[model samples]
Target: MTHYRIDALRQTLVLAAPSDGLPHCTFWGARLPDGADLAQVAASAALDLTGGMLDANPELTLCPQTAAAFPGQPGLVVRSPDGTPLRPVFTKAGTKRTDTLSLAYTDEDLGLTLTFRFAADAATGIITASTTLDSDTPVLCDWLAAPVLPGPQLADQMIDFAGRWCDEFQPVTTPWATGIRARDNRTGRTGHEHFPAIILPARGCTNTGGEAHALHYGWSGGHRMLAEELPDGRRQIQFGHATASDPLPGTRFETAPLYAAFSDTGLNGCAVSFQRHLRDRIVTWPQPDTPRPVHYNCWEAIYFDHSLAALTAIADRAAALGAERFVLDDGWFKGRNDDTTSLGDWTIDATKWPDGLTPLIDHIHGLGMTFGLWFEPEMVNADSDLARAHPDWILGPTTQPLGRGQYVLDMANADLRDHLFTQITTTLSTHDIEYIKWDHNRVLPYNDAAQTRGTYDLLKRLRDAHPEVEIESCSSGGGRIDFGIMAHTQRVWLSDSNDALSRLRIQHDAALFLPSCVTGSHVGPRTCHTTGRIHSISFRAWVAAQRHMGFEMDPRELTDAEAATLTKVTAWYKANRDWLRTADILRLDAADPAIIAEQQQAADGTRFVVFAGHAGTSTQIAPRPLRLTGLDPAASYTIDLANREDISSLSRGTPALKSGPLTLTGQSLMSQGIALPYDLPDSMWIIEGHRA
Candidate 1:
């Protein structure tokens, strides 16, 4: 028997290989003592024999094999070229260890080799694992999971996400069951309906306390997740590409990296791990030193109706309101007056701007705001010039039904990618554009792993050519938001629904895997375009301020008072954005269920800001005290209600915080919590704190 251990600051994973078979994780949890005995630990984890069971239980290896008689779902499923199911029993062949670990296993008779790789980052407390399969001859890969890991036995329920167009990042919790709980996303995109992540919280776990484990499958195309508890009571988690995503026979197949984390400090620990890893490690910023700019998008403002005069005036107003970037949304391309036409035609619309986009770009630059343009390069309208000219470039059958009046382009085709690269580069070279809002308004008719790889290739090529330009991944809202796509883009449009009430919940839940810097939340019109619900400017502004601040509403529609409120919040965001950009967003546990709140703490723990949104009316009279987390308990701090003036008239008695700032020890503040000023539904209270 051989034992190996990988350690992060907060957790450790120990793998054991017995009888020269593929290694299986024997222990995964809090870090063990440096002098601990690995061999004894592996022996301690063994299950005793029972009646009706095999004399010796088969090891649940990294890639559990059918030939090994493992009871749970096999991690790798493949077949020969003629469709004969192949069961390859992998045996230890080689091992490599450094900062990262790699183990190789071979099945000589099957002419196949399997390898598992793991890299543990102590700073981020995340362990990234992946699996690869190599065959001497071509084989069809039905499913290939990343390195399988043991699920936490103490966890009673697991949380996954399910959402739709205007609503994203909604958590769905399920109790642990005897059989498998599987989630498969076959939409060809990292869909809003199926976010590729799972969280296992122990029985008493909360947002800020107790043990938890999480795994995010960092693949944007599509994925399958399985959390299975065998009859023998052992649990295993498996994540991989959507079953049969690779339809063609190939000699090599690999699964995308699966980011796994263990948190003894609760769900927030896992959240912070993913957040920091994505922002600090995975995403490559174009301008690393620059502060995130306040964005103003003109999709809900002007839609497809483009006029130079209207847009220029809007740009002037946006600049006045403190917008540092102006993004001209859809309808900019040739003959594109609506979503029904002109997709895939990247040329500027001569009729919409006879002078081209130069005038708008120049005017925006003149106002001290950078310019960004929108593009849907992956989709084509049937009436588009590209589609009409090269019908073969369409991905699916000609008779396939259209989605949102557009069809997916064959991204797997090098020629199509080359054409798109040239078209996009021509525009980038023609203008002084600094950003691109890359939008995918529709899903592909079928799933194809090659399509995602091809898109990544094109994005990489573009980034290499125009390294200074930044990109945002926007797929009709939150469709393609995963670590995979984020590798090539800087920001993500959290959702299309700009309703402040909805945004409060969405942003809070999304913080599990996304940090504030890369999450783009925008203020919309008084009446939301998607939900048709009206919200006050203060509520909208504060909610948007929770992440990468932006505005998506028309400035012309704002009343003077509304505009004043927006400008004030914009200024506040700008003033604190330097620290806010890198802050760890800690979700507060509000005693009142109606309140959705979060605390953004500075890296040094010297300053913090809390945004408490009154999502709805409280069940009982008066507001309940909300407790904050991730604080220095022994330090003294001063807390002030930044928006005390927004308090409603119904609050007759003066709350201590409503009247003036209070100084207290962090322990007292966290233990007893703070009483916030009374506010109505759809309103938000801003509280600022500083160490005294």
Candidate 2:
């Protein structure tokens, strides 16, 4: 039999591999500076080693759980409990190189992780790293109860937010997820489901006034992970590669790559998700001051007849219905609306805004509405005025192999950051811009400047400059929609996919861990950029309620009836938003064909149950009339009769469910708790039950 040993002395952690075949590894200078309790420091290191592995894997090979929990002389070891050697012997393993580095250790049996902080009384704060985990057997990940689970308050916030997500209408009701996975012996990776895990992003970081470090968790690279803290107290995770063979790219793309921060995660980088998890816990959710308009938009209006009159006409229609805000989207920006030309120029196109955007603004405002504008300030056209004027200003690589994009700014440079910041700030501050829909068209085309990583610094600087702007982040749509992005930005366009049914899936999955205000649902047109599926009028507003709702279609063409429905729904959201905003969400079940996650928030004596779902009620037997989990049933209450269609259905089928009394119970009828037979597809019922 082979054995493993680990020891923690002050800031040093030494793992001694069995002489039989496993090699031992020693890591020193592992303690936090400023002299922590030496014993506590040692215990912390041991725990980090034990738990880090366990956090990543639940099924263990050995009974190292107890040993890791109480590390001293022999330390702790993990192996297959069924006496199967999980990994092969690696008596002499080769060393590897990586871009970034961090370390994490886990207990195999108990499934625990012990993430190390600073080394105890260590010499260098810069942190040097080394490790030796043998190539033995595969360990199945299972980190159910790690010390770092976001606290109860954060968890509750997530549940509440998730409930709203569920409440949004989804045709399939079942939580739908699609992802691409690599095939062992295939040409391309295939998309698969039944996910082992998922990543949910609420809003692209809403620029809250705070430190950059606070939002950061870890970085990835070289298989090593490093975590860091910015001056403002926000956390960031860094990633490093796991091996030393080849230098890894620091570029951010969606693949299994290493990231690093400064934490004790030794994958050459930090894990991609730890800081994101932390960010999800701390950001504050701000409700909309005014009920936003169920707007129509046009990025496609380019070359598709987006004249000022057409746009005003759209605004006119939206206004007639009492919508609060009307946004004149893209094509209006200086010479834009195509894959080329006029990007750096932020002026309005006279060709498009003939009466000067002021008339449109005045008219929209005259109609008792605020006006919004869109800007893709991150990129530049190779032939734009800004590029031609200040050629050196654009970010470019000195050497060859520069990726795509004709013009990119040097965001890392202070002058450039200030330049771009001033431009955007000036525009946003100067105009009747009640709302600024900020979009980042691309991640980064090129950052090969000898100076610094410009794009990220530029964003951080912009966040600092425009703290109060109601900014929306759009990297295409789903890109960069992380807590880091949300910390500075208020809302994120949920997806380019605005089809209400599709939104049900995107939003239901998104809301589980995001703030309610972070979700962005646009009352998209009959067909647009994503999915191209048109939605019913009712389903549009039903799902849009998940987050800040807007319009993504041409406002002018909506039928008077469509406009009226929009007006009514907007009013409804405005009237009772308080209930939805502050309620606590309880995810009732995850396996239903239509997953049910409900929210209950109390303001006065009224308790609101927001039943968020994926599929309509037809999946189950009228859900047992939804025997609400926490309610004083005997108390008198008034179920909001807002759902007339539901009223009609109950009257016809479930005749037992009468409004006058709480004692209305009927026998199982032909109609289960499904949406009314002849009602709209995605509708929300604000059932207000009170302690009568």
Candidate 3:
């Protein structure tokens, strides 16, 4: 038997290969001491023989094989060109170790080779693993999972995500069962309904305490996830591209990287790992030294009605309200009076602006703000010039049903990608545009891995040409958000619903995997256009301030008092954004279920800010204590209610926090907690903390 182990600062993964077969993970948890024996650890994980079992239990290798008699779903499903299922039994071929571990196994008779790669990052505490298959001849791959890992035995329930448009990041918890729990997203995009992530919390786990494990499949295209409990009681997790997403037979197939993490410090540990890895590692920023600008998008403000006078006036008001960037949303392109037409036409509308976008761009720059434009480069209206000229460039059948009056551009076609690249770059080169709001308003007709890869290629080519421009991935809001797409983009529109009440919960849950810097949360109109519910400017502003702050509402509609409140919140966000951008967002455990709260602690642990949002009325009469986490227990700190003036008149009794700042040890604040000022539903209280 041979033993191998990979260690990060907080966790360790040990694998064992017995009798020269593919290695299987034997131990994965908290870091073992440097002097610990890996061989003994592998031996300790061995199970005893039982009746009704095979003469010998087959090892659950990284890629469990059907030929090996593994009693579970095989990790790799493939067939010969003639459609004959191939069961390739592999043996150890080679190994390489450095910062990352690579192991190769070969099935000589089948002329196939399988390789597993693992990398442990000390800084982010994330373990990224992937699997690749190479064959001498072409083969049809139905499914190919990233390196499979053992599920923790101590976990009683698993947490995944399910959401929809306007409502994203809804956590769904399920108890461990005897059979498989599978989720497959065939939408051809990183679907809002099926986020590619899973969390396994132990029997007794919370946000700030106990053991937990998490895995994020970093693929923007559709994916499949399986958490299976075998008849023998062992569990395995497999994540891969959606089954048969690759239509054509090929000699080489590979799975996207699967990011795995172990956290002894509870769910927050896993959250922090994913957050840090995505922000610091996966995403590549154009201007790393510049602070994130306050964005003002003119979508809900002026949907398809484009007038130079109205937009210029709106830019002035947005600049006055502290917006540092102005994004001119849809309807800029020629003949695009509505979503039904002119999607693929990248030229500026001569009727709306006979002088072209230069006037608007110049006016925005004059107001001391940068300019951004919106584009749906992957979709084309059937009535569009590009589509009518090259019908073959459109993906799927001509009789296929249209989505949102548009057909998906054949991204897999190099000619189509080249055309888009030239058209988009022409505008970027001709103007002072610094950002692109790349929107995909509709899903593809079918799942195609090549389509996603082709999109990535185009994005890379664009980025290489225009290194100064930033991109935001917006798919009708939250549909195309994952580490895979994030690799090419800098920001994500969290959701389309700008309702503050809904945003509080969505942002709270999304922070489990996304950091504050890349999540774009915007303040909408007094009456939300999507939900038709009205909210006070104060509630809306604070919720937007929780992430990459922006405004999506029309400035012309704001009353003087409402504008004042927005300006004040915008100033606050700007003042503290430097630290908040890099802060670790810790979700507070509010004793009151009605309150959705989070603490943004500075990297140095010297200062922190807590946003306690009153989502609804409490079951009891008074507010309960909200406990904070991720603090040095022995340190002394001063806490002040930044928004004490927002307290409601409904509560007659005064809470200590409503009066003045209180000095206490971190332990006291974490254990006993702080009493917040009484506030009504849809209101939020801002509390600032500093080490004393």
How well is each residue in 1-692 modelled by candidate 2, as lDDT tens digits?
22122222222333333332322222222333544344443344232324333343211111123322312111122234353323222222222224322233433443333232221112111222222232123332211111111111111011111111112221122111221111111100000111111221122211111111111212111122222222222222222212221122211111121111222322111111222232233233233454334444545433335676676676676656545766666667667656577777887777776666788778778877877788766567776888788777765543323223445555546776677777777766667776667665542332222222344465556556555446666655654354445555666675666777666666645543344555677777766455665666655765676566666665565677777777777776776665555443333323344543444445343555444443454455443333343334345443443444333343344422334323221111111221222222354443444444
Candidate 2 lDDT (Cα, 0 to 1):
0.41
Off by over 4 Å in 2: 1-304, 387-408, 445-468, 527-529, 590-592, 595-597, 603-605, 609-641, 646-652, 655-686
Worst 10 residues of 2 by lDDT: 185-194
For all predicted structures, in order, the TM-scores are 0.99, 0.57, 0.99
User: For residue 635, what is the lDDT in candidate 1?
Assistant: 93
Clashes of 1: 0
Sort every candidate by lDDT, greatest first: 3, 1, 2
Show pairs that collide, candidate 1: none
What TM-score number comes out for model 2?
A: 0.57
Q: Per-residue lDDT for 1-692 in model 1, tens only? A: 88999887788999997656789999998889999999989999899989999988888778888998998899999999999999997888999999889999999998999999999999999999999999999999999999999998998999999999999999999999999999888899999999999999988988888999899999999899999999899999999999999999999999999998888877889988899999999999999999999999999998999999999999999999999999999998899988888788899899999999999999999999999999888999998998899999999998999998999998999999999999999999989999999999888898899989999999999999999999999999999999999999999999999999999999999999999999999999999988889998999999999999999989989989999999999999999999998888888878999999899999899999999999997898889998888888999999999877688898888889978999989998888999877789999999999998
lDDT of 3: 0.93
How well does candidate 3 match the true structure in TM-score terms? Answer: 0.99
The CA lDDT at 601 in model 2 is: 42
Report the Cα lDDT for residue 112, model 2.
33
lDDT of each: 0.92, 0.41, 0.93
